[model samples]
Target: MPRLPYLSGVAAATAVVALLAAAPPPSGEVTVSRPRVVAHFDFAQGQTPENIALEPDGSADLTFSAARQIAHVTKQGHTRIRATLPAEANPRTPVVGDDIVLGIARAHDGTLYVTYATGTRKTGVWRVAPGGAPRQIAQLPSNGLPNAIGLDERRGVLYVADSVLGTVWSVPQQGGTPTEWAKDTALDPVPGSEGGFGVGANGLKVHDGAVWVSNSDRGTLLRIPVRRNGSAGPIETRATGLGGIDDFAFTGRGDTVLAAMFLDNELALVRPDGTHTVVLTQEDGLSNPTSVAVRHRTVYVTSGAFFTMRDPNLLLADLGERHDR
Candidate 1:
C-alpha cells in the first residue's frame, strides 16, 4: 500500500478538528441535495476502489488501487475480480512501496485502459482486453506520473493526465509513443499549497467536443478544445476553488458536474457559472471519495479512504428527483 508520514496523537487530533471546522454546516439548502447510499463494500473485500467505469449492463468496473486488481460490481451488488495486475507490473519504486493502479477508461469495444505508477520512473499506461493479460500501451517519461485517462473514440486517441509533470498527453489508441497534447500553468499545483501527495493534473474526460481535466492540488477544472484534425487547441478554465477536485463526470446537463473533493471529504455539484454546492459529505458516509460516475439518474462514487478513519466503500446515489432541486 502507498504509505505517508504518520502524525503524532496530538497532531492527528488537531487535523481532525481542523477538518471538521472547515466543513460546511450539515443543514443548509443547496442546488443539489444529498444522495442516498445504494451499495457498500464489506470487510471481506480488502480493496480500495479508486476509479470507476460503467458497463453496458449497468455494472461498475473499478480499479483496486491498493489491491492491484480490477473488480466488477454488478448492478445487483455482486462483486467479482475482473483482472489482476502481475507482480512485475507493480514493482516497488523509490517513491511508493508499489505501483498503484489509478485511472481507468472503458472503450466502446469493451477494452479497458488503466494507468499506474509507483514513482516517476516506473509509470505506464496499459490496455487490457477481457480475459487477456495487460499490455503496456505507452511508457511515460521518467518524471511523469500518469493519473487519469480519457478516450476520444471518434478520433482513435487516448488522452492521459500526468500529475507530476502537469501535462496532458495524447497517444494512439493502438499504443505507441505519447505526445504532449497540452500544458499550462493552470495544471500546476496551487501556490501556497503544502503539496500533499504531489498531485496536480489528476482527472481526464472527453465531453462535448472537448477534453475536461481536473487539477487535484490546484482545485481547478479546465477544458481543452479538440480540433477536427485530432489535435488540441487552446485550454480554458471552467471552474476553480473546487476543494481538491478529483475524477468527475458530467450530469448530462448544461455544464453541470459531479466532482469528488478528496481533501474536503465531500462531493460537489459544480455549475457552469463557476459556483458549487456540497451535495454529499463525510456525514453522508464519504470517507475520501476519489471518483464519481453517473449513469442516467444513478450515481456511483468510490471512496478510497486513503488517509481517513473509515474503510473504503463503493456508494450509490439516486439523482432521480433530488437532482432537480
Candidate 2:
C-alpha cells in the first residue's frame, strides 16, 4: 500500500544500476504511445484502484484500497462499486498503515477473491459471489500484510503473498486454513529500508504451472514451480533490479510480462530472459501505478497515486495487433 522509498542517493543509484540488465535499453530505445485515460478517480474520496480482475464480458472488477470497496469498470469507461468491505474505526494493520484492500483475483463462476490487511482479526481473504456479500473464506496471519492473492484453478487452491512475513501461503479453493506454501530469503525485505512499509512479495500470479512473485523491497521477481503433489518446487529469481515493482501480468506470450513500477511511476515489459523495456511512464498518465492486467491486445494499469496524492486513474494501452494471450 506504500510507495516512494526514501533510500539514499548512492544506494538508490546502485539499485538502479543493478537492474539495468532488466531495464529497457534507453528512453528512446522503446517507443510506447501514451496510454489513454480510461477513468479518473478521486483520491481524496479513497477511490484509488489498487488491483484489477478482468472479466470475460470486457469489464474489470477492482479493489479500491483505501475505500474498502470493490468496483466494476465497464468497457465504456464507466465504473461503480460492486462490494464494500467493512470499515474500521481504528486500523491496526501492520507497518502503521490503514486497513485496505490490495490484490484481487476472479474465478470462472464470477466469484471475486480479495486480500484485506486489517490490524485486527478480520484480516484475511474474502470472497464475493456476483451480487452476494463479502464473506471471509480464509483467515491468514494477522501479523503480516497480505498484499496479493492468486487462484490456481488447475490446482484448485489459492496462493497469497505476505509482504511483511516474506512467505507464500496456500488455501483450498473452497476456503479453509492456509498453509505455508513457500518461504526463503529471496522473498524477504532488504535490510536498509527506511521508507514505505519495507514490503516483499507484493504482487503474485499463478501461471504456466508456477507461482510468480515480486519483491518490492528487494526489486526481484521470482518463480516457484508447483510440484505434482501440490508442493512448492525450487525457487527461481527470474528478474531483478526493478525497484518498487508492485504487481504484474503475463502478456500470454510465453514468459513475457508487464510490470508496474510503483516508485518510478512507470510500467515495464519484462521479457522471458530477464531483460525488460519501459513501456509507459508518468507522461502516459502513470502516477505510482500499483497493478497491471492484460486482456488480449489491451493493457490495463491502475495508478494508485499513493505518493503523488493526485490523479488516481486507470489507463488503457493498446499493444497494436500483438495479442496478449
Q: What stretches of model 1 exceed 4 Å from their correct place?
A: 1-39, 42-46, 88-97, 120-122, 190-197, 321-325
Residue pairs clashing, model 1: none
TM-score between model 2 and native: 0.90
Q: With candidate 2 superimposed using the best TM-score fit, by how many Å does residue 286's alpha carbon deviate from the native? A: 0.4
Model 1: how far residue 79 lies from native, Å: 0.9
lDDT of 1 by residue, 46-121 (tens): 4777899999888999888867688899877788888876554436543344667878999998999988776544
Best by TM-score: 2
In order of appearance, the predictions have TM-scores of 0.85, 0.90
